[model samples]
Target: MNNNCTEVEDPYIRYVMSQRPFGWNFTDPPVFKPYEFEKVDPFYWVSLMEDNWKVAFYAAAIYIVAIFGLQKFMENRAPFELKKPLFVWNLSLGIFSVIGFVRYVPGFMLVLSQPNGFYRSICIKDGMDLPTGYWTLLFAFSKFWELGDTFYIVLRKRRLVFIQYYHHVVTMIVVWIVGPLVEPISRWYTVLNYGVHSLMYPYFALRAIGIRVPVFIANLITFLQLSQMIIGFTVNMTSLYHQQIGNDCIRYPVSIKAFSLVYGSFILLFGKLFYDSVIKSGRRQKEKKLL
Candidate 1:
């Protein structure tokens, strides 16, 4: 890290330093480094996938074929009673989500507490390093594991909603592309996702274990999903506005546009899900009681 704040040419950094107290240097090395992967890069292969569009295309093709193929295969079969395995899977993912939230959020908060840390958090110029990088990489690869979510739906012979599959497909591609790039704003994406998954997976786990979860709790998760999409869209738009003004913030136009489209769609889909699951459902129940 450069100590001479005056020599830093990046407008974002300069702005950060300008907000500091006299003689304070925003360029000073941080007191703590974030967590990092040890022993080996667990995400090495996934990182390689980012190098070519063909890899993503191939993976996506396989994913689509497998989903439809499985659906066809199970057309005449009875639903699998996967209660025990489903419980384990959801519990594991919930734990992982909690771990991700714990590992990354403190570093984020530490940066945000610094002078102009809020701006630094959103427009980090140096890119992700240490534990945050390791976890962010893991977060990206986790999307592949998430594909199994739909598999459970298919094996259980449940109706697979278009929104559910669409979200899974786009997420796999987006994370693969954006994770390796390590845009600063990507922190928002990871943090919000981890936060949601932390709650969501545990809820699913409980249900899988035959614990009766309230319908409202499930509604809350969907609401959180909608909120995440809205916030993600807003963050991307903010970054684009900053880029347009030549603020010297780190910006990736391609990722921003892709996120806009994906999250924009999510807003509509989740909104509909929320209305159908909560509002419409509640109205029908009320009508039932009145009858």
Candidate 2:
């Protein structure tokens, strides 16, 4: 529901907060406060990010270099059996992502609960709550932390696919740059990621501990990954469309288009992965069952 934004400093207004079904006051802007510190400015990282666009480029460069270097270094080395460590690594990430999903998803829903929520969901920046704000920052930095996934792969001499490493490189760069911005569409990014990874990493943790997960559960995660891409592409296009129609809240059309291209590529990548891992395999499994 599009209405005239109320103020220059804080634009949202809460005239009918009583009638709001979710009981969240949409009028007050959400401010991100750190977990236990009042000394820190809540918006400090966001301001820093605005001035440091090149940080993403530098981070990506470092990550790509490290991936290859590790791959080379691990050559001729006996693969380390790191069962306990790998289990801890995946379990920790899975737990962190679970917390993030809980903190962030509610705020995302609150933004969408508003009138014209779809537009606001794509356009408004301050719809996030205080906890979501903190978790968003953590999730951004965690991209680099999650690079350890490749470390495990390389050290264990596992087949490191191009998609595995490439996906990590791109996300680390993009999220480092864009995470603080917390663009309206990033609500979708943050939620889907935390939600999906809540299952994904834990699944890995189980496998790391040598537990066999059901085939359907594994397929569901892959399917959810594909769903995230399709949703990303759609949301970006919708935001771009709103921008074209002159919504000031939509802000950066260029960034929207760039994200669209990124999601478009992912759609193809994940689409193929889904077919090979799920659809095609499902057919073969069914044929086997019949026999």
Q: What do the candidate models score in CA lDDT, each in turn? A: 0.76, 0.74
Candidate 1 wrong stretches, greater than 4 Å: 1-49, 126-129, 289-291
Report the number of backbone clashes for model 1: 3
Off by over 4 Å in 2: 1-40
- Number of backbone-clashing residue pairs for each candidate, in the order shown: 3, 2
TM-score of each: 0.83, 0.83
Judged by whole-model lDDT over C-alpha atoms, candidate 1 comes out at: 0.76
lDDT of 1 by residue, 15-49 (tens): 43333222211233333554334223534543364
TM-score, structure 1 vs. true: 0.83
lDDT of 2 by residue, 64-155 (tens): 78878988988978998999999999999999999889777777887788898888887766575557666777777788788889889888
Which candidate comes out best when scored by lDDT?
1
